[model samples]
Target: MSGLLIGYARVSTDEQDLTAQRDALTTLGVAPERIYVDHGLTGTNRARPGLREAMAACRGGDVLVVTKLDRLARSLPDARDIVAELTAREVKLSLGGSVHDPTDPVGRLLFNVLAMVAEFESDLIKMRTREGMKVARAKGRLRGKKPKLSPRQESHLVELHHAGAHTSAELAELFSVARSTVYRAIERARPAAPSAS
Candidate 1:
């Protein structure tokens, strides 16, 4: 099936380059206008405007192309869901330089295998992070992000909050911090109750 050859390009940060992906698609003869791009947006975010536009633009026999698979999805479930949608619409996917036909059993198997590998890699990262956090906690080094307000400021914040004269918003504004920060500080300042039998 022959139709438009569409391309999608994405960069997670402003510092990264979209030139390479754009050039590759252009070299492959995809018109510059047909190529959609999302700048400074993370791949983990599924609500990318450019991606939405590209998908909306797709029709049966059309191909969705990406320079890399990660540019399309960052997780296994996300990849699987997207492939499922494309297959339902009879749209093909082109990754790197290979065109993958989701209708073919072999291609479906290959994509599912890649999705599982991606999931495994994601799980390994989470496991490593948990281990690191556990070690840090054992050393009394694991903690929430450093407070934006200093100790003196925090004390004043707690004082103002306890006075019951100011709203949390007022306290936050007075302390030049977010209302959530003021609430957290107030919570931390709660007195311990007498022990129960």
Candidate 2:
């Protein structure tokens, strides 16, 4: 064989299982020795060591296999860059069990369309993020993570602590908050008391 048929697989979180992907790639004719796998890494990241190694090992007429294009790259621009590089070296790009060789005009067109869609998806995400922030800001929200405690709630918590009427667990129950919240409230109020000195 002039080129090796290699497979690359990944899953973002530790809890996720990659058995299915491995099985699919095996059925697609890739062997364990030629497979590179990564676990608990985000799809948006390009710094995967195994991925880099596979790409570097790819020579003229080699195949770079991925279960899905998204599993290989997050956005369209990056996909295009990788695809372009592979095409320049006479490499083939295969995804989701499909053989796509850029040397052929039909495959080239498919790659181009896929790249465009990826770029468009990224732009849409950015635009939605901006609009979401705008909406939150308009409603007097800070447009980021909310504070652990509001000023009014903190004051009430402090007063209750002084009264000694409710235990931390009881306060959590009363306020419909977590036990951790009650503990945090007590800590925040405790320092201000005269006995802490």
Q: What is the lDDT of every predicted structure here?
A: 0.83, 0.79
Model 1, position 19: C-alpha lDDT score: 97
Which ten-residue region of model 1 has the weakest summed lDDT? 188-197
User: Model 2: runs farther than 4 Å from truth?
Assistant: 10-27, 31-50, 57-61, 74-77, 88-90, 143-160, 163-197
- Residue-level lDDT of model 2, residues 1-197, one tens digit each, is 66778888888778999899888888888887888888898656778887888888788988889888767776666787788888898888789779887668998788677766756765776789899888888987865667667888877876787788888888777777888987887787676876533
Q: Over 4 Å off in model 1, which ranges?
A: 118-197
* Error of model 1, residue 180, in angstroms: 28
* RMSD in angstroms between candidate 1 and the native structure over all alpha carbons: 8.0
Q: Which one wins on lDDT?
A: 1
